[model samples]
Target: MKKIILLCLTIVLYNCNGNAQKTAQKTEQKAYKVSKTDSEWKAQLSKMEYYVLRKAGTERPFSSPLNKNYKAGTYVCAACNTPLFKSEHKFDSGTGWPSFDREIKGHVAFGSDNKLGYSRDEEHCATCGGHLGHVFNDGPINTTGKRHCINGVALKFIPKE
Candidate 1:
């Protein structure tokens, strides 16, 4: 019984990989306009921002204050300050996090996420490669038909002047 248990544990440990490298791996091969060392990122970002951006971790739904924001402004990358989304494209997806109908052209990048035993469309900042969040097809009609569900921690809103 002990031998079998050990074998099972070994197999589980060897085959099941965590989501730790999910974002990092995706950014490694692609170069971003704004690059920073891990230490630099940690020093600059808050703990929650670091977790959501660098580690590709998800923030709790409806937890972000930005989710309810409806002001005119722009959402920029929290890590690199790269402009990503506009308030005009924002919407209430009710899935929490800040949902947008679209992104600022050329500011966001897309990738694949399979951490949940299925495939998901992941998004990140094209400027710094910071993990933003995932995009889904279930969005408002008569528009882009794409929901860019982004992590608020990964963004900082700059009100229009």
Candidate 2:
């Protein structure tokens, strides 16, 4: 009985490890409209921007000035300047990052991310494929009820003139 239990545990652990590896191996196969070489991207983006946009890194909560920004304007992709979230959809979710209820139509793309040991809807720039952030269902009930938590380093705030 002990041997059988040990063998079953081993098999289950191995399968779980393999599944995690497989999930990590699934890269973004689709090409973006504004693809660039690593060096080119490094040259165009700041160190922090490169880290968050290219490496799928997250900024510390409440670390982005954009989180407190309430000016009216549009937020564009830091990499390719593609307009993403509008100021109208911006909200304060108090999650320490810029929160939005919606994004510009056809500007942001969604994909499954299991990097944090759970499934999350990851957002990226449709034009440059830059990592933006994650979206959650807990948002303002009167609004779209979607919280688009974005990294400030991944966006450029273009204030309305």
* Candidate No. with top TM-score: 2
Clashing pairs in 2: 62-96
**Candidate 2: tens digits of C-alpha lDDT, residues 10-118:** 9999999999988877763779989999999999999999999999999888888999999999999999999999999999898899999999989999998899899
Worst 10 residues of 2 by lDDT: 21-30
All candidates' TM-scores?
0.83, 0.85
lDDT of 1 by residue, 65-141 (tens): 99999999999999989999999999999998899999998999999999999999999999899999999999998
Model 2 residue 140 CA deviation (Å) reads 0.9
Candidate 2 wrong stretches, greater than 4 Å: 1-28
**Backbone steric clashes in candidate 2, count:** 1
